[model samples]
Target: MKTQDIFVLGLTTFALFLGAGNLIFPPAMGLDAGTSLTSAMAGFLITAVGLPAFTIIVLGRIGNTNNLTKALPKWLGTTFWVLLFTAIGPAFGMPRAVTVAYEMGIQPFFTNDHLVAFSIIFSAVTLFLAFKPGNLVTYIGKIMTPALIILLCGLGLAAFLSPLGTPAAPSGDYQVGAVTSGLIQGYMTMDAIAAVGFGWVIIHAIKAKGVTTQQGIASTSIKVALIYAALMASCYIVMGYVGATSTSIAEHGVNGSVILTRYVAGEFGHYGQWLLAAIILMACLTTTVGLTNACAEYYQDTFKASFGFTATVIVVLTGVIANFGLNDILKVSLPAILVLCPVAIALVLASLAASTFTVSRLTHSAVLITATLFGTIDAINILGKMPKDLGDFFSDTLPLYNAHAGWLLPSLFMLITTAMIGRTASAEKKFGRVDYRLKTANND
Candidate 1:
């Protein structure tokens, strides 16, 4: 990739990653984390940037998403990816975008009447983008990102001119779990899901600026990711700092977007309000477009729907769903995230755990079995009714589980154990070494 290719790809990747969720989640987590912002930021970066970049770079290296997805056992890998992105888009994400757009973008105009009208307006704008899906990265680069930057700059400057007093330390035991909360909040951002799809988008961005060959594209994407991630990390650091310090917005237990707008306004007056409105609108629009386009592409591949029709249907459906309201979206979304996040983390991070291990199919199978079983139980325990004794037993007596994630520890143990055994078996059969089962799948 040439110099311009790297620059454009980096900007495109940044556009892909930034969103209203990104802005909203980090601040709230920071607000609660207080003095723990450093640790929380570390955890957030691991999941938000590290894991996401891992997903995209790995996919770029592989060069074929279908093969990458298909390489996993029983088709679980792709299904997990699909379900995650779908949830991030239609189920929770789009609606959040709608309401956020209403609060931050449209509220300034109507002040009273805007909420109802803005919901419809936000959905309509999203619908237009979804209907006219194009090369997503390029489209954002050409239009959406410039608008986003102007707005962000205005807000940042406004915040600089007038400041909210540093916030107080977190209340109660929640302070102890700030790192864990940041990790969980990272899941809500859906960066891992974006990681799966944006690799191709990154490649396209690179190639458009003139990159060719899988190796070249992969190398360039990594460079771009590194640069983009650093900038994003800086943004998180600043926002986290702001949230940690700011005391102007009284804790109403309101939504993050509401908190953000009120905080800005209290600090910088009406100018901050106007600037934030533009930022939210632009970010939401870019996110909505990128997500809808990705959904269209995946579905077209799966069901033979023409790209145009598939994209249109996704936009309209999600837009209509936005009428449901932001707070309502948050309720169901949190439950779903608790279900999907661990599995997504497992799948993406397994490649990193033993990067040299090449047992493609067996590794995928083992991780899927371990994670899915555990994730389901974890979700059920958290979100659904289960017998008291049964829950306690699983939480306490299970090999490597807890009330929170009875699946996580056990699942990890299971995958590593299975992979080692499979490796031994493979090695023994091939080299007449030992008859250890690890030889079977370990080499992979």
Candidate 2:
């Protein structure tokens, strides 16, 4: 690909990742972290930026998310894929984008009564844009993303030049283990899962730009991931700073959207609110379009449905779900995300290891199964559904249980144990060992 083409593709990928949670979470985290913002932001970037970028690179090498599960049993692999796409598609992600755009972008200035109407309009636009997947790169990269970035840059610049207030004292979880708190907060963005779901879209875009070979695709994906990570990290830092300084304008523990609106209003009055609205709308709309396109394509391929029909169904579903409101949507999404993210991480890491080592189907199954089991526990704990005794036991016994990452150690243990066992079996076969009965008979 040409230098210009790579930049455009990178911009498109960046826009796709920059959506509802991406905009809101950073600032909310920063507000809580206050003086501890640096350490907290560091932790946030690891999962928010690093993991998503890593996922894209891995997907490039593996072809698509389907390849991540090709080694697993057919039923299990298909189940994983379907659940992942559903979570990040109309079920949670796409609808969340619509709600965020409305609440943050439209509701603050206008009447809060228009969410359903706004959702209908938003879904229509998303459907129209998603109707042609091929045009996403042109639509988002060349047009919408640039405008969104410029508006954001202006807000960031103002926040830096004219401060809102000095950073407030750290609050709540930010007062202790702020980094870990930030890490868990980053998990809520769900961008890593988006990367997996968006794999086919990115791959097709790269192919469309004349990069056909596996090596070419991998190389280009690395470049694009780097660009996407850089853009996201930069925005997060700026937004975090804006949040940290807005203590004078908004109370600590307020919604991130509230913090942002107050900051923009303080800085540039009514016009600034308009600018912020435009920023939120563009950010959410681009994401909705990208997600709808990707999800529609996946359905079309998997079920042999027409693209138009799938796209229309997804849009209608997203619109209806958006009316459930942002808070309710988030309440439902958090548990789902907690359950899905660890398994997705395991898949990404397992795929990377497979590229370099002789990973067996058994090893893959062990790692993913361990992740799923522990991830369910984490989700139950988060929902307060786990028994108090069981939750306390896991919290005290598990390494990162309190940090919402209890799955990591168990998953790693399974990976190593299964891998070593597979290695031993391979070595036994290589050394010309026959069946145990034959060897015993010969010795007798």
Candidate 3:
């Protein structure tokens, strides 16, 4: 792809990932972290920006989401794909975007009574834009994303020029293990899951730009991921700084939207409020459009449904779910997000390793299975569904259990063990009653 085309694709990728949690979580974390902002932000950037970029790079080599679990059985792959797409689509992600936009952008200016009308209008616009999935790069990357960036940059500049106050001392979880706290908080963004879902759109976009070869696709994807990471990291740092310094103006423990609103209003007054409103609306709208398009396409291809019908259904579902309010949506979604994120991380890492090493299907399955088992236990504990004694036992026995990531070590161990076993089996079969040099030369 040409340099300009790559740049545009990068903007689209950035916009697609910059949705509800991306806008909210960092500021709230920064507020809590305060003096510990550097360590907390470091952990936040790892999962929020780094994981998603790494996911894109892996998918670029492996092909789209359908290829993600190809090593598994057909039924298992389909089930995993369905769950992943649903989690990042109409079920949680898309609705969360609508609610965030409504709460932050429209609710502050208007009354709560306007939620129904706002949802309808918001979904309608998303539906219209999503109807032409082919034009997403042009519509979002070329147009909406630039405007959103400009507004965000303005807010960032104001935050930098004027000081709010010295950051307060770190509190609660941030008082200790701030990095782990931030890393867990980053899971709320759900961008890694979105990256898997958005892989098809991006690959198609690159192909549309005449990059059809696997090497070309992977190369372009790296460039896009770098650009996306740079933009996301900058925004997170600026927003975290704004939140950290706003203790004098805004109270702690409030949602990030409120903290940001207070900071912007204090800095720029009424006009600044409007600027924030514009920024939230644009960010959420682009994400909703990209998600709707990606999900609708998935359904159309997988289930043989009509694209228009699927799009309409997804939009309507998102609008209805948005009425549940942001806090409620987040509360309900957290358990599921917690369960899926570790598994997604494991899958990304396994895929990367498979691309480099001679890995077997059993290795991939074992790693993911370990991740899923532990991840489910973590979710159960979080939801208070597990027995207190059992939960405490696991927490005490498992490393990083307090961080909501008890699955990592076990998954890594499973990968290494299963990979070694597979390699041994292959070696034995190849060396059985045969000269290694003769076989190697014949194969070559």
lDDT of all predictions, in order shown? 0.67, 0.86, 0.85
Q: In candidate 2, what are the lDDT values of residues 1-444, reduced to their tens digit?
A: 999889999999999989867878888888889999999999999988988999999988875557788788988887887887778888888888888888788887765489888999899999898898888899999999899889889999998999889899999988988888888888757687888888878988998898888899889999999999999999999999999998898887799888888889999998988988899999999988988888888878677989999989989999998787657876877677778889988888888777766666687788888999999888887777889898889988988887777888898888777767877777787665567768889899
Error of 3 at 375 (Å): 0.4
Clashing pairs in 2: none
Residue 384 lDDT, candidate 2, scale 0-100: 76
Candidate 2 global lDDT: 0.86
RMSD of each: 5.2, 3.1, 2.9
Error of 1 at 387 (Å): 6.0
Candidate 1 off by > 4 Å: 73-78, 111-124, 127-135, 157-161, 177-181, 203-212, 252-254, 326-337, 350-355, 381-406, 432-444
**Rank list by lDDT:** 2, 3, 1
- Provide TM-scores for the models: 0.83, 0.94, 0.94
Identify the superior model by lDDT, candidate 1 or candidate 2: 2
Between candidates 1 and 3, the TM-score winner? 3
